[model samples]
Target: MAVLQVLTTSVAVALLWVVVESIRRLFFHPISHIPGPRLAALTWWYEFYYDVVLPGKYIFKIQELHLEYGPILRITPDEIHINDVGFLDTVYTGLRDKYEYPLRALRVPGGVGATADAKLHKLRREALVPFFSKRNVLSLQHLVTEKVNQLSEIVASHAKEESQINLSDLFFAFSNEVRGEISGIMKVQSSGTDGKSDRNPTEKEAVYESVLLNESLPPQERTLTRLEQEGALLALAGTESPSLSLSIIFYHLLANPSILDRLRTQLETVPVDASWTQLEKLPYLMAVIEEGNRLSFGVTARIGRRAYEELIFTPSSYANTPGTGTPNTEKSYKIPARTPLSISTLSAHTAESVFPDPFTFDPERWLGESGRERKRFQMAFTKGSRKCLGIELSNAELCLVIAALVRSFEMTLYETDARDVSFEHDYQIAMPKMGSQGVRATVKFRV
Candidate 1:
């Protein structure tokens, strides 16, 4: 009995050793071939700590890793970082269908923004695209212009009183109003001046920010009406559409004075009575907005694609071949059916090869003939067939508001540290921290 016991113990110890060693080898060895910290070799905690626990440091951490380890680095057993523009174009633009965004439930509830399957994504895009169609977005120009005028009036009122205004807060107010009006879902008003009537209902009234974020119970009217209001409010709150992109552009303009001056000069060139119909003619204004997008990306946390079937990221003017910046027609990565591949846009946008001086904010690279030349490289609205439906709408709105803004206000940055305001980003969305003075520019109306 004693002899049998001793033999059994020895076998058990050997098996345990093999199991532990295997886990270590699987995580550390295979990915060990890829560059990254040795800690990443042991566990994904290395990435989790920096990305989640640290405030506004995910981009910096990833940038640091790529700087040390080249474009491809291992963050975890399932995730690898691709920083090269070629890799980005290949994976994000080229093999766009291969990646799926895993964290959609947090934003758009009821799986409205969630599309793991490419076919579902296609259907959703098709359904949503018409709403943001060029004709539709253009048709709503008067409405957008009205909202802009209201917003400007509110800020201009404060300027007249010489009262310090939080422009950052006002930007959100304006964005919420525009998004609400266009989506035809919610009404958010932010200017809080009461006990007086000055402008139309659309102009002087204040709407709560809660309209965009939370649901409101209407006063008892009718059973069906109340129920319908509850449902609509819930749906609006649940929709996982990200709106940080609007803030990104706003902050970019507030920080760069020269860029503001140039934009204003360009706006002056456009006729005073110009409308959204005239947006296409002002290429420089469009370029500035696009450049802001390039510098300030909203979706950098995670991207992946759920495979409907076995798919390959083949080279054919889309994929970047390994070790060669040159794109290949051959399939590079073999993605298994139902697999999800993640990407980091922060890494992709800052790649030096794609845009020279990638860190600097320069709109000229994307303006006029020069801008036309780089059309193939633009990914502000993303690429491929499933691109953003609101591209034209967003373009038109941005052009109208920005042009009007430059024409009306002379902006001077109020805070120097504001430029350093970083992104408090997570898996799917990024936004400025509450009360961030990133855009404390005083708006002096241009006479």
Candidate 2:
């Protein structure tokens, strides 16, 4: 009876502690004044429920929260999310020292993308800059062309068989193979009389060898383990996002016949051997690519950063002057040092004011002088110093492979639903709805 009484007392004490802590978080926390769901203010489980339990739905939920609470809201107990377009440049760019939120589960310790310290990230990024430069990517055009041709041939074979091609898988394979070739993972013959001779060298051998061969690397940074880590990081970074974008682009093109015809008409002017440089110059084609990126939801999570020093955020007129102040003005809010903040690219890309009829797949929206101006708001590749290192390479692949596919075949959805191509979940990267067959299509080889 005494032991039972002690157990009851402990349970009562635990419940009391929880209630007191909840009260403090709701009423006394530094961010409590910033309006948000009461549960979110009290505990992180509110975020975990949407991001974890529902999977990618938090992105949509965030949009709904902005409708209820305003442009700025406490997304988590410790983090604030801004839904205004004007603040993206300020937050992602500039001379401020920013540290990514320390979610160790999402980070690969010691990897380039996971390097949180500003100085260290700079050093790591500098070591790889030469390999991913625009000049280097242009030099590697043949490698991209080769993979595109291979993908076309596979599509042709599938067309002949009348089989549905899983574009998601197809794009992923093409991306992986192209990365392999560019990184010199695939074998290449050297200048030698006997091709089998031991003296013959392969093309740079591996990305690790090429990157570390530079005399610029510090002695401590040249370790084999670091090379392996960076290589794995580059491989994943180089493939997934671009492949996902390609799948969505094709899905959109196939869904809209008139747009597909317009794209094909534009492509008819390009010679069979046209370079990506030339292809990139075609206005309508470029618009299609931009539209694809805008709709793709690339890296569709809130990329959070903590300030090493005080950070100031100024909201746009839409956010600041909602019947309470003058229109088309800005209001500044000073954020304390070490406060977590983020701008969701997914939200930014779909802002109705920035891109009118934001939900529609309209390549025409990306044309003309006004369209060019709106491109400034497109954060598909993100912005600032920590922007994607593989941007040039990814763009090259998107142009070459997409052009090749459109030029070589006519594609249509096969036993595929609209939801299959929709952005259903956010797993850091955007995912099509669950149970999706993954953008399947039938193809007919163009004569």
Candidate 3:
């Protein structure tokens, strides 16, 4: 009798799943119009399974789908994946003032990362903007330079000792140090020694990493993954991080050494004392960093107005796009109220219309007159009042780190084949698998 009861319950659950899927298919014919794997049409489980279980392979899946189905595809009943910048423009900033999507939680025991309130998101963005403001970033130039110089010395010492310097480790340390300074946290020693400086608690590190490192905890234990996911949902009603973008920058630099050389030369022109005011002069470094962000968009999704009360137009907006008109007029979608919309930044970044040869790491694409045209389509940092508050700071950090390293050391891949420099990325905020052929580079002292 007990065995029969268990079987009956299992069968009932399976039947319910089929019914739910069938109902979803009936109402979601719009999703059916877009092409994807058959499994995706019948249910979202196929995509979710791969997303959660095989994140490393999932990156290519979207790209493959684009090759097969043009620019737009559907991931679930409500989610649409667009590889066309024009459509993204219409959706992300066009017809909708806001949309809805799953929020991310990167840590547990606390729900600081998840919340869907737009007002709260605005408050948070406003609060954090000062840290990444042009003035603040300029003020931190000395600190950035100091850290970069210190890093160079450490790398040089390792090179002299015939020790292989793990670029991945160094980059993390570098970013951590920079993050610490920006956030007013304690210094992070990269040499992994010197007990003099007190470091912030390990938890104060990238709050976004909570998901990547905290997947195993039971529900009762309040895992980092749960915390981060929940926190993201509440805070921004979305999710994103800088890990993948950083790793990809290094990967591409190694793959295309010429590009790195060009960037180094460009950085050479910027005087160490030059303020952020002179940022406009360093086009090449800016281009490289932009291309890096395009290729490895940190925050892959966002939610904004699903429908709007009015309409407005402003194609020149990059970040901070709320200026287009009434808070929701920038879009055309005439979104009905309370609609849930999700925009995929990866798709937008790779849109052929927005970026010619979207797959190539061409900094020139961003350096020419056509660069203005590209700007009209660029949304990696996103646009609107909700644009990434860290944009300016992140750019400065990238410039400082790249320029400093190139000036002090000759960076080369430790692996014989540049392709070997690759790592498996598990995509919840641009993270690479912790240990797969990570960034091992030999930094020779240039002096």
Error of 2 at 340 (Å): 1.2
List per-prediction Cα lDDT, in the order shown: 0.54, 0.75, 0.54
Q: Which candidate, 1 or 2, has the higher TM-score?
A: 2
Query: Per-residue lDDT tens digits of candidate 2, residues 162-277?
Result: 77889989888887743343334212322222223342232222345555556677776766567656766677767778888888888888988899899889888989778999
Give the Cα error of residue 143 in candidate 3, in Å. Answer: 2.9
Over 170-252, each residue of candidate 3 has an lDDT whose tens digit, in order, gives: 66666553222212211222334433244343212333332222334335324434443334433332213333355567778
State the lDDT of candidate 1 residue by residue for 75-194, as single tens digits: 665555555445444455433353433444343322323444555455434434444677666656777788778877886886676455665566556655333332332211233323
After superposing candidate 2 on the true structure, give the runs of residues whose Cα lies further than 4 Å from its correct spot.
1-24, 95-103, 177-206, 318-332
Quote each prediction's TM-score.
Answer: 0.70, 0.87, 0.69
Task: Report the poorest 10 consecutive residues by lDDT, candidate 3.
Answer: 320-329
For model 2, what is the C-alpha lDDT against the true structure? 0.75
- The lDDT of model 3 is 0.54
Of the candidates shown, which would achieve the greatest lDDT relative to the real structure?
A: 2
Candidate 1 weakest ten by summed lDDT: 204-213
* Candidate 3 ranges beyond 4 A from true positions: 1-17, 27-38, 94-101, 104-114, 177-247, 250-257, 272-276, 301-305, 308-339, 416-426, 431-435
For TM-score, the strongest prediction is 2
Q: What shift in Å separates residue 48 of candidate 3 from its native position after superposition?
A: 2.3
